[model samples]
Each structure stands twice: as structure tokens, then as C-alpha cells.
Target: MKRVLITGGLGFVGSHLTDELMAKGCAVTIVDNLSSNVMTPADYPGCEVLVGSIEEVYPTLLETSKPFDEIFHLASVVGPAGVLQHAGVMAQSIVMSGEAVTRIALQHGSRLVLASTSEVYGRAGELRESDGCQVSSDVTVRLEYAVAKLTSEVAALNRAKVTELQVNVVRPFNIAGPRQLPDGGFVLPRFVVSALSGEPLTVFGDGSQVRAFTDVRDIVSGLQAVMSSGKNGLVLNLGNPANEITILDLAQRVRSLAASKSEITLVDPKALFGPLYDEGIERVPVVEQAFSELDWRPVVSVEQTILSTLDWYRRRLGLSQHESVGVAA
Candidate 1:
């Protein structure tokens, strides 16, 4: 079996990626600190689980002389709310962890795949990996996350230029599906959970904010394709532009699909995320590069993604699944 290492393999995205890698017959080893989304060794029965931060465990792995064939660097402080809540630690962790992983990949001659965020695009439209990112110097939580991710991207690319390391950076755009945490400032999960529990679905800022919600499964497939593309120093935007929907519409759709008597309420962003929170006006990725390079396109529709997410939450919460709710358009 091919040996692979994932830095944040227990995280929402990382965990899902781990399942995908294992299904492909790869021997997966996970390194996680269990600080954010906690998962135990029991969660991954067959895989090796190292319970420590990447910085703490990477050196020990190197000392073993068992080099990994591929490294997926997915460790970082995620979510705007979480980052803002712990800015100092988040900033330091992102930069330091990125440097350490890059060095480890170099030493092991491993193909490195870095998980970046769409937050680096700021308020730009039709976001592409080649387009220059636009971010303000405001010290806000969103900006902090974006800047740190951008810095990591630049560092990885620079390293790839000088070395034979194959580095591919992926900017995932609002990936949502089952296993996503509701309290992580992720809109889709929050909506699904609230609607399932018969609570009001909160829509911020008159709900005009548009987002292209990509399914996590599609994102995983895209990541795997990027790894096999044999392309070095390339940044690809993995998102489905066809799934673009406004916040209000999304909330309403979720309520309908869940067949719940929940109300859709509008709230101010400041009330939820504080004054420092500057919401992105719109986020839509230009995914032509992903299509051309990886021959990949997101096959899951937004409606199906929402229904599956709702079903997952219901099953986990011990609520009955709404079989009456048919597959969404």
C-alpha cells in the first residue's frame, strides 16, 4: 500500500479526506492535536493515529526513516469566528505549522498538498487561483485567516520552485456536508441543525450575501485528482460555481427540505460575530482550471448536499428522517 500522511486528519475536511484515502488502499497516518474537532483513535480503527500537533510529531516521524510518499498538509486554525476568538494563537500556529510541514515534505521528498481557504480572495468576484487576492490590513479575524493562508501558499510555491517537491495548493470554497460542525460559523450545517430542531434559521445582513456551497465529497475528489495530475506549483480553486445561492434562499430551501415548521429570521452580523466581522459580499470560484487539469466537476447538486447534511444531522441527533422529502432539484 502507498504510505500517506495527513497533518489534520481528524478535522472535518481532513477526516473525510482520510476516509477517501483509505478507501483507495493507501496506508494513512493521521497527526492531530485534538484541539478543535476532537476524534479518538477509535474513529479510525485501521489507521495510525498520532495525538500531537504537526510541529511536535513531524520530527519524530522523520527520525523513524519511514518516509511518507505523499503528505496532505491540512492543519490550521479554521473558521472566521474561531480565528477571531483566538487570533494570536491562530496566527502563530498557521505560520509555524506551515513552515514545519514544508520542511518535512522537503526532507522526505514527498508530494505536498496544502489545504488553503477561499477567504484569501476577500470580497472579490469570480475568484481564480491566478488572480491576485484582495485583502485589507485591518487586523480582523477574517483578514487574519486569509493573510495566514496566503502566506502559506506563497511559501509552498516558493519552495516548490527551488526543489523537486511537487506542491499543489487547493482553495476550497465553502465546503459543507455531513460531519461539519454547526458551531464552527459554517452556515449550511448551522441552518440544517437549527431547522431540524424547529428553531429559526438565522440569515445575516438581509440575506443578500451569495455563496457557492461545494459538497465536501466533490472537494475530496478534486484534491485527489490534483495530487495525481503530476503538476507542480499549481494552485487550483475547488468549488462548484453552479451551486451559487443567496443566504436567504438557502435558509428557506433548508426549511422546506426538512419539512420543518421553523421560521427564517434575519439578524445583524455584528450581533453574531461582533463588529470586527466583515462579511464577504459574494464568493464564486472560477473552476475552469480544475476542469481542464483534473477533468473534475462537482456532480452533487446543492439541494442534494443540503438534504444529505440534514439527514446526517437527524440520524446523529436521534431524530426521524423525513422520507417524504424527495431529492431536491
Candidate 2:
């Protein structure tokens, strides 16, 4: 069996990827600090769960000569609100985690996959892996997260070039699905929970921002494919362009799907997330590379993703799904 190490394996994307790798019979070892994750080590029975940061546990792994064929570095302070609220801590975590994981990969000759965000593009249109990142120079909390991710990417690529390690970067678009928390300023989960609770679905800044939201399942599959067959030192944009939608449209869709007597309300970003928050106008990915390289394309529709997310929230909140709220045609 292949041995795999995942940092932040308890997180939203990490958890899903852990499930996928375990299903494939890989001996998965997860290192997580559980800062933002909800699942415990007990949740994954067969896998080894080390309850600590990558910086702390990776040295022990090296000392013990624990072999890892693959390492997925997904540990980072995610979400707009979370990053903005704790910019310094987030930046520090990224730097420490990136260094530790890259060193581990080099030591063990393991294929390394780093999880990046579309935020690196920073208000760009038709985002491709080749496009130069337009990170803001302004002293805003948003730039801290983007800069940290970019720094990690550069460090990983530099290591790959020098050490000849197999390394790939995946910049995922707005990935939405189960196990996402509403408190992180993620629009979809907040809307789903509000709609289910008969509260208004809040739309920020006129709700005109366009985002390409891919299902978590599709994103995880693409990550796996990249690790398996992707060329070394390649950066792939893994997202479904077909699922692009406006925030207002997303709120309306969630309200309709939940069949709740909830209002769709518009709120300013300043009021909701303070002055540090700035909205991106558009985040559409050009994913032809993923298809040509990995033979991967997202199969889940936006409606299906939204419905599945709603179902998950319903179960978690102990609310029964309304039979009358059928899938929109």
C-alpha cells in the first residue's frame, strides 16, 4: 500500500481528500492542529491521526524514518474572514508548514502536492496557471493570505527544481460542499444555514461578484490525478467554469432550494467583515489544461452541489429536508 501524508487532513478539502485516499487503500497519516476542523482523530478509524501542526510532527516522522510516498500540503489558514482576522498567524503558519513539508518530501523523495487558492490571481479574469498573479500591494489583510500562498508556491517550485522532486501545485476555485463552516465567511454555507433557519441570506456588495464554484468531490479527484500523472513543476487550475454564478443568484437559488420563507438581503462588506474585506469581481478559471493533462473534468452540476450542501447542513443541524423543495429543473 502507498503511504500518504496530509497536513490539515481534518479540514474541509483535506478531510475529503483523506477519505478518497483511504478508499484507495493508501496508508494515510494525517497531521492537523484542528484549529478550523470539526472532525476528530476518532472519526477516521483506520488512518493515523497526529494531532498537531506539521511543523511539530514532521520532525518526529523524520526521526522515526516514517516513509511517505506522497505528501499533500493542505494546511493553511483558509477563508476570507479567518485570514483577514489573523493575518500574521496565517502567514507564519504557511511559511512554517511549507518549509517543513518541502524538507520532508526532499528527504523521502516523495511526490508533493501543494494546495493553493485562486486568491493568488487577485481580481483577474480568465485565470490560467500561466497568468501572473496580481497580488495587491496595499496593506490589507487579504494580501497577507495571497502573499503567503504565493511564497509557499515559489518555495515549493524552487525546491522541485533544485532537488528534482516531483512537485505539482493545484489552485482550486471556490470549492463548495459538505463539512464547510458558515463562520468562515464562505458564502454558500452561510446562505444554506440561513435559508434553513428561516433567516435572510446575506449577499455582500450588491451580490454581483462572479465565482466558479466547483464541487469538493471533483476538486479532490483532480488533486489525486495531478499527484498520480501530472508532470513535475506544473501548476493546474482545478475548477468548473460552467458552474460560475453571481452571489445574488446563488443566494436566490439556495433560498428556493430550501423552500424557506427567508429573505435575500444585500449587505456591505465593510459592515459584515469590517474595513479589511475587499470583494473580488470575478474568479473564472480556464480549465482546459486539467482536461488535457489529467483527463479530469468536473461532473457535478451547480444545482447538485447546492442540494448536496443543503442536505449536509440539514442533517448536521437536525432539520428534516422538505420533500417539497425538489431540485430545480
Candidate 3:
């Protein structure tokens, strides 16, 4: 069995990835600072779990968890609120985490996959991996998240050229599904929670903002495929253009699905998130690369994602019927 380490392994996508790897008979070790996921070590009975940020616990990890066969680096400060909270230090934390993972992977000659965000593309529409990113301003906190992630990607790929560090980057577009926290500014979970709660589903701007939401399960599968892609310094886009929908339409769908009396409200984002938030343009990834290179294609429909998220949240809240709220903040 391949021995692997997943930073942020307890978080939404990472936790799902852990389940996948373990099911495949891989020995998995997971570390998370609990910044995003509420899961504890006890939550995962089979895998070894460590609780700390990548920068904080990597040293302990290096000395104790020797010779990892592969590393999945997904830990980073995330979301609009999180970015603004750690503004000046966000890039530093991200780059340091990348370097730490690179060193660990290099020491073991392990395959490494860095989970980069689609936000790096900034404004997007049917985006290819080759398209240049358009982060409006470095000073903007929202854009800073993208710029910082890109910096980490560049550093790792540059190292991959000369070193034995087997590394590739996967840019996932708008991941959504169970266990995704509303705290991270993820739209689908937020909408589902609000719809279940019979609260207004907030649609920022005109709600024409388009997004192609990829399910977390498919994303985890894609991440694993990258490790076997056998190409260093490769960058691939993982998304489902088939699931694309307008923000307003998404809100309406959620309401109908949940059978909620909640009004779909159009509100200024600034009114809710303050000035640091920038929603950017439509996110639509051209996923031909992931399909062509890894033989991977997103199979989950947008409606399935919504229904699954709603069900998960309902279960978490201990609700047998509709009405939900108190999602982790």
C-alpha cells in the first residue's frame, strides 16, 4: 500500500480524499489545523490523524512520518473572510506550507499534488489551463487569495524542474457537496443551508454570475488521477462545465428543491461581506485537459450536488424534515 500524507486532510475535499485513498488500501496520515473542518481525529478511525497547520506540524511530521510515498498539499488559508483576516500574512503562510510539503515530498521522492483554486484565473468564462489569470489588484483581499495560490504553484513547479519532487497542480472550479462549510464562502452550501432554514437565499449583484460547480467526490477522484498522470510540472483544470448555472437560477433551484418559503433576495455583497469581498466574474473551466490527460470527467449533475448538500446538512443538524440553520461559521 502507498503511504500518503494529506495536509488539510480533515477539511471538506481533503476528508473526502482521505476516504477515497483509504478505501483504495492506501495508508493515510492526515493533518489539519481545524481551521475549516470540524472533524476530529476520532472521526477517522483507521487513519492516523494529526491536528495542526502545515507550517506548524510539518517538522513533527518529518521526524515521525518518514518516507511518505505521496503527499497531497491542500492546506491554505481560504475564503474571503479568511483572506481578509490574514491579509499581509496570507501569502507567507501559503508559500511556507508549499515549501514545507515540497521538502517532505522531495526527501521521500514522493508524488505531490497541490490543490490550487479556480480563483487563480480571477475572471473566467470557459477557461482553459493556458489562459492568463486576471487578478484585478494585489491590494484587494479577494484577489490576494488567488495571487498567493499562484505563487505557491509557481514555486513548486519551478522546484519540480530540477529536483526529484514529483509535483503537479490541479485547479478545481467551485467545488461543492457535503461537509463544505459555509464559513469558507462556498456558495452552494450557503444557499442550501439558507434554503433549508427558510431564510433568504442571498444573491449578490444581479445574480447573473455564472459558475460550473464540480462535486467534491469527483474532485477527489481527479486528485488521485493526477498522482498517476506521471508528468511533472503539469497543470490541469478539474470542473464540470455541464453543471453551469446562473447565481439567481441556482438560488431559485435550491428554494424549489428544499420546498422553502424563503425569498430569493438580490443584495449587494458589500452589504454582507464588507469591502474586502470581490466575487469576480463567471467561473467556467474548460475541463478538456483533465479528461484528455487523466481520463477523468466530472459525472455529478448540479441538481445532485444541491440535493446531496441539503441532505448532508439536514443530517448534520439532526433534522428529519426541512428547516435548517446554525451551519458552522
**Clash number for each model:** 0, 0, 0
Model 3 Cα lDDT, one tens digit per residue, 1-329? 78999999888898899988888999999988887775678889999888887887788777764589889998888765557688778888888899999988887778999989888887757789888777675568767778889999999999988877789999988889999888877788888888877688988899999989999989998998898888888899989999989999999888887877788888988887788777766878898878878967789999999989989988987777555553222
Candidate 3 displacement at residue 2 in angstroms: 1.6
> Candidate 2 residues 1-329, lDDT tens each?
89999999999999999999998999999999988896789999999999998987888777646689999999888887877778667788888898899888888888999999888887667898777888666867778888888898998898887786789999999999998887778989999888888777889988888998999999999988999994899788999999999999999988888887788888887887888887678889999888888978899988889999999988988777763222223
Best model number under lDDT = 2
Pairs of residues clashing in candidate 1: none
Worst ten in a row by lDDT for model 3: 320-329
Count of backbone collisions within predicted model 3: 0
Error of 2 at 55 (Å): 2.0
Candidate 3 global CA lDDT score: 0.85
lDDT of 1 by residue, 1-329 (tens): 78899988998888989999999899999999887764567899989999888877778877657788888988887775666676666767787788878887888888888999998887668888778888786767778788888898998899788887679999999899988886667899888888887778888879988999999899888888888888898888999999999999999889898887778899986788887666687889999988888868898899999999988888887877783222223
Off by over 4 Å in 2: 323-329
Candidate ordering by lDDT (highest first): 2, 3, 1
What's model 1's lDDT at 153?
Answer: 90
The most accurate candidate by TM-score is 2
lDDT of candidates 1 onward, in order: 0.84, 0.86, 0.85
What TM-score does each of the candidates earn? 0.95, 0.96, 0.94
**CA error at residue 121 for candidate 2, angstroms:** 1.4
